[model samples]
Target: MVIRISKGSILILCLVLTNCKDSNKKLKETTVVSNIEKTLNFNLESAIADCQTQLERAVPKLTDLTKHPRFIEKEDTDWHQVPNDKLMWTSGFYPGILWYAYDVTGDNKWKKEAIKRTEVFEDFKNITEHHDIGFMMFPAYGNGFKIGDKKEYKDILLTSANSLATRFNPNVGTIKSWSNKMHPRWKQHITIIDNMLNLELLFWSAKNGGNPVHYDMAVKHAETTMNNHFREDLTSWHVIEYDSINGKVLNRHTKQGFADDSRWSRGQAWGVYGYTMVYKETKDKKFLDFAKKLADKYISLLPEDMIPAWDFDVQSDPKEEKDASAAAVVASALIDLSSFVESKEEQVKYLNAGIKMLNSLSSKKYSGVGKSDAFLLHSTGAKSLGWEIDVALIYADYYYIEALSRLKKLEKK
Candidate 1:
């Protein structure tokens, strides 16, 4: 006898098979994601050891405390030193790296070297020709005071904040980033996104016994930058020229990006890190929201490895250089920003992004082990000017160590 099946039974059988296939596909996707996360789980202790080894190699090569490593040229084994006497903006990062090493390893030698290197910048407080005094002083003295609680470091930081405040034009509501003579085309008061990082010194000083005007200056500068420096998409312009007398934006342009309409990777990183720091100091929700927007935009533009090109809009050539310094800076900032957000989803997203970037930097592909004296390699600085491209930068090492230290602390929490 032939058994007859209803059309309804056949439809039910088909639906069950379809459901099983969908479930299998989802299970495979989840397994892939789990494998990626596990692979990206970095070894913090080993990463820190690599940094210590690099620092050990670097210290013996420092012939003068006044001369600090800025960047290494391509195929060069030795770091090119720049004199602190010139008040170079990159000076503090070397001492800051030493301080980070000291923090991570509890090594007295790194502390001694950090103090020695940092003391060279004591005279920089009096040089207020530009707005980079914070960058020159904070990493050395700010981290020094935080770690050692030295009164001298606090006094130096306060003095440096005062000098930075002098560059803030009340009318323009922002700090002048460069001197007119330096950029004759920008005849008016000009501010760059990098200036946002300098405001942290002012915010810290105001809370730690400096004048309240420093705080006000920082807030105003951040507000003005938030208003004028960002496009609708939250990508930042490298420079904003303002009429010093009228407090009006005169021009929105680029100094280091591919074009005036393009986004500079380091500049965008500065905005992300700076706004996160500003929110931390002020506890303002607006700054925090703005920082999240900046961070999301930056993260969305990154390649699969979580590293960005020197500029986002540069023609996508196979040889396009990556900015590990920018990645390091944003990684450190994202870790800090992760802790500040209230949403668990957002916190996990940011923390995971930070970790992924750190993992990429710590891998053999980026680590400077046995190849250079720096902790990481392939950082681009001002590619438009044929400056330091795909080389080791001191700030990259500083922030990479900072991010690792932060992750270690966060793990404990």
Candidate 2:
């Protein structure tokens, strides 16, 4: 070894060593990328772990909220503020989380809590004519059925579906947005794309409960929404007009957007996810095509970190008030849509985009360490409604898990 020799030989040896080091570095980088891809592909074990930790921390807070129950009066965190009695709708979302918690940890405590929480709503009929019955009912009861195979949960879901069906106005071709009890004169009005989320439960109800009318009505509402709610750019409006008595398009309005003409961020997200879900259920090419188009528009506008501003078209400097919930919703729905795409490239595009958004969220800013709340991050509510700057909302948590579940399922397959 000591006989080494000329400078040329030494130079050659140095070059080889450097080359090997460079190759190793490159290999490490590639491995990191692969791990990220695996994370995106959906690892249920990890997702379940994250979900359980969040749930365990959040449950005590929920239990505290119900110490005294009343309509929209039950005390909750600042962001998730709703009446105790009316908050029963949110109770639906919790069981699914609880179920997830139970499923992941095999914890009897989670199972008991889920069952007890669901039992509270066993006779809890009388759904308010809000735009989120699906959120209210499906998470609480629909998921409850999935978790435990309870007939009562199934029955309540069907009943809620029936109530939702009644809210449908044949004239508007959409479900009336809200019950007039909150506003005497607006007895039957069509507004909000949020209802589209709830309509899927109606489809489920029809299929599971033998009511074709419910499925038909859900499709009608979805069709009505796609035609009227979406703007040319695939942006969406929060309010629209429908001849409630005749099911005809009256006009498009913007009650919730920044202006009657501005594109609201959450509303756009609602449209993207809703139509995508509709496409999944109905296999309607129009809906799927529209979903892809809107998704493209949405992804194009995303900020550097992938979280969207509360309103995409808002001219003000980007605000942290941006909705993380929207990203979660879109990601979860995109995963669902991925299965329907025949092209592997197309599937990867949608799924990868979603994974990027979720990973960005899980990083420092969106999901802080020891946050203790079940929420992932980013939720904003109407200031006039006294819910501005709400964080870690229930819906955000729900969809975040949903996205996680979809990703995890893909990995297994």
Candidate 3:
């Protein structure tokens, strides 16, 4: 066939060819992307099933450990009375797991128990001037209030938030919690990254109660922690010294570790979880970037199977071992940190690392199974106190369930 074109028709023909080429290129790219997504979808389904199994095993123990004034003894025989004092911290972790179980299984039992047990905080009005009130309150009441819409939880949260806000010392630009009459060194208002957890309560309270000042106060505390508590490398000490009288940053030190500069595994885990949480609440790129930086460094330090010792830098020639509890907490935190990553591959890597650690814990050697202590496997409390060591710790259960919850959410997504 003879084809004849005028000058105007020539331009139109060129335009048509260009448009067809562009469309072809676009379609090819779309097909590639679709294939990649399909591969990812398949992998996620298999990985999620494996991850869910481990998390499922964690739920029952997390439940029994957080109940009443007692837990099962390791002797594997009977229920032992947990000191009335210890119950508060243990109780702090219950609601999150309960709610999570409900979310995953749609189990009314889980929701019912969660709602019922969280009521303990209703009568539990006293807020301790401690670094752990976030873990001690939010998971029980603040989370309950936020998720379940329980008025009692809200009331408890408001009271606790008021008390927490009061702990903010203007001079230190942070909350003052650690103090010991017997040990004068423990005195003075200081900043620790761990406070990042509790500061969320302040944010929650401010948003819920129409108080902007509480939010601003929380920002100040977090800023102070960001500036002072972290080292130049962003690895953190357990404590940072401040001039409580003048609100000046003084020094960074370790409170519970072997030395001021040595890295305590659990302390770093707290940093990992706390800063990631701070990023989630604030949406500040600085906090998110800082969290990613810390997570990168922390993840690099994980041993085989991604579990870390209590102290990452501890020397082994003298036979000092790592704290398994620290590994558990960090593993849990890493699972949360995974959600914040920009890349699917990075998220999968962190998720896999967490799963590796969890699988190791489920193993016979470290889990301390059949012992009946209501704890999982490894924890090291103050050896100076002659207390917990290599035992399943409550916070471990908390993070375990928290990680599991995150995994469950990912599965649904």
Candidate 4:
């Protein structure tokens, strides 16, 4: 306006204009950062795209060379086919992976591959010796039934539940994990944290009109596990031997972990996933509360990377390897667990923990999705104590896909 004004007034007006310009720039910069945070939070679409790419690379190698997907990438990345009749604990996961690939990509190639791999498990549905029927059938037949609702898939799952039910010892109040004769030192019965996983089969059977005994068996097994398999801190033991005559807990031990008193990461994952499953099937508050307790204990012990060592008790050893598969399993379970919690803070805590793990798993450090024949690598299975160490395991691949698939669904909703 060029009106007459004092010198000090002119300087003050210039200072005010400069401050306004600085404030606008700061606001714009903050807005850009906020947008970046939103974009980077969890991109489900990009994750799914990465999965499709990973599967396209990984699945063909599995199907082209092997009649059954064995998953221990051998010489020349040849699909090392394991005998389907061996009844390995992870036999079902291969087919499950195929099913998931089919689910996410809607590719008939993956579906046909899944079906071909699943057909071999026809014999698995009738075998009753072990407690991995859920692991063996659900990922294959359960997803088969889910994707198509085929009567055959339903029938196989039902029959497998019956076979699994027969292993439940009424005298011991839990499903026999393995033959008592195999581990006769217990002299009664043996159950494991792994057994909790098998209860999903029983629950599904009971809910789907198979048998009430299946349901009863599941409840009893879960109750037994909740009482004996867990310690005061909610960390689980791998196995619990019981007195066959009186159902008394004979001893608690660890078969696949660092020590008897140590926390096996996968075993804890099994417990968390199984109990959350029980709650899902029964809507039981006790199971939900127990799952939350276990989740809290697990989250508290997570290393800086948010991944767990093969055993929580391996703190004494700097050479201890991280169980990325266990982390994947727990991450998958936590996504589901978050939905059951009534508290918002608890829900956010669980969900963020899962998202952090999924992010870590997808990073270059842990995700060797395309580098080798395996879809996901850096998984430490059974550590150096067992045959497989720092290798890509079929279960690890299965659960990694599963966790991604789960988060994608949640994001869509």
Name the candidate that leads on TM-score. Answer: 1
Q: Which stretches of candidate 1 lie over 4 Å from their true place?
A: 1-39
Off by over 4 Å in 3: 1-81, 86-88, 126-128, 146-152, 180-183, 315-322, 368-375
Ranking by TM-score: 1, 4, 2, 3
Residue pair clashes in candidate 3: 171-247, 310-322, 310-323, 376-392, 379-390
Give the lDDT of residue 281 in candidate 1. 95
| Clashes by residue pair, model 1 | none
| Candidate 2, poorest ten consecutive residues by summed lDDT | 68-77
In order, candidate lDDTs are 0.88, 0.68, 0.63, 0.78
Clash count list over all predictions: 0, 14, 5, 0
Candidate 4 lDDT over 366-385, as tens digits, reads: 76655655555666667636
TM-score of each: 0.90, 0.81, 0.77, 0.86
Cα lDDT tens digits for candidate 2, 172-254: 77777765575453444766777788888888888896478988898888887778777777787777766656656656655
**Could you tell me the TM-score of candidate 4?**
0.86
Candidate 4: deviation at residue 368, Å? Answer: 1.8
- lDDT tens digits by residue: candidate 1, 1-413: 99999999999999999999998865654443344347787777888999999878878998787588999886986789987764488999998888888888899999998888889788898768999888888899999998755667888888889889889899999999999998898999999999999999999989999999899999999999999999999999999999999999999898888888899999999999999999999999999999999999999999999889999987276589999999999999998998899876787788889989999999888999999888988999988988898999989988999998887666645
Tens digit of lDDT per residue, candidate 3, span 110-173?
6777786666555444565565566677887765675566765666777777777777887777
Residue 107 of model 2 has an lDDT of 80
